[model samples]
Target: MPIPIELSLHRHSRVLEIAYEDGTRFKLPCEYLRVYSPSADVQGHSPDERVLQVGKEQVGIDKIEPIGHYAVCLHFDDEHNTGIYSWEYLYRLGNEYEARWNAYLDELKQAGHVRKTLDA
Candidate 1:
């Protein structure tokens, strides 16, 4: 697993920066993190049962807590705090960001949902 050496959340930019031991860094947008949350609400119990999240274009993290040297729990402003993102999962998310984000957009379109930014 590519463990993170540094983690920084930029509230103003609504991005989370994670630097790994291998010198790789990822700047993940809050909306992407929220929609792709590892929580059961999003991932479900199985691949076939995964839910398509929508209307989280402006979602942001309110807080973050490190979990026992393995993962981090993200507290979103929308009150989502169940997901515990492991270093491996986070690494995958970052590395496959473009494809995953595109897939999400396609899913939204197919579901006839429109992306909207929440008002500050």
Candidate 2:
């Protein structure tokens, strides 16, 4: 069964609080969700063809518009509004976050991009 998500924004953490019809909960960081958007505009058709999105350290979702009942169209502060976030995609992203995030970090390091280490 397909799950429907009721998403709410956590302004302080810059996270999207997601609750599925099956009672699963996900607190998806805006940056993580942004980078993993499944839209063709972001994912493209091939893995190597993916574009690197940089300068999103301070990016946040400014608004989320409902697209029928299947997805939510997010508008980011950086003006990236092409990705339509469906619930299935969001769930998959959440599930794969750890591996994907690590890979992203490795890719950034390989590309000579620096992610500042936090004091925390």
Candidate 3:
């Protein structure tokens, strides 16, 4: 698995910048991370039990806690601090960002929820 060489949080822009040793970099929005959190509260035990997170367009990370040599725990400003994001998972998230993001948008649209525009 590729390991992250750097992780930078851009609080003002609500983005987490991750650079991997394989020369791949991803600028993940906080909202995306929050909604796609790997926590049980979000992912659930089964695929059908997963929860769809809403109203997280402006969610920001309050803190990032490293978990040994394998993962990091994100503490969201919304008080969500359960997900243990492993290096592999983070890499996957980056790699599949476009498809995943579009899927999320589609799901929201199907649920009849309109996403609010974030204030710049």
Q: Tens digit of lDDT per residue, candidate 3, span 1-70?
A: 8999999999999999999998999999999999999999999999998999988998999999999999
> Which residue pairs in model 2 clash with each other?
none
- Clash pairs of candidate 1? none
TM-score, cand. 1: 0.94
lDDT of 3: 0.95
Give a tens-digit lDDT track for model 2, residues 1-120. Answer: 457557889866789888888888878888777777776777888987787665565668999998887788988877888898877788877778789888878877888888754322
RMSD, model 3, all Cα superposed?
A: 1.0
Q: What is the C-alpha lDDT of each candidate?
A: 0.93, 0.78, 0.95
Give the poorly placed runs of model 2, Cα more than 4 Å off: 117-120
Which ranking of candidates, highest TM-score first? 3, 1, 2
lDDT-sorted candidate list, best first: 3, 1, 2
In the predicted model 3, the residue pairs found to clash are none
Q: Per-residue alpha-carbon lDDT of model 1 for 46-111, expressed as tens digits?
A: 999899987787778999999999999999999999999999999999999999999999999999
Go through the candidates in order and give the clash count of each.
0, 0, 0
Ranked by lDDT, the better of candidates 2 and 3 is: 3
Cα deviation in Å at residue 69, candidate 2? 1.1
RMSD of each: 1.6, 2.0, 1.0
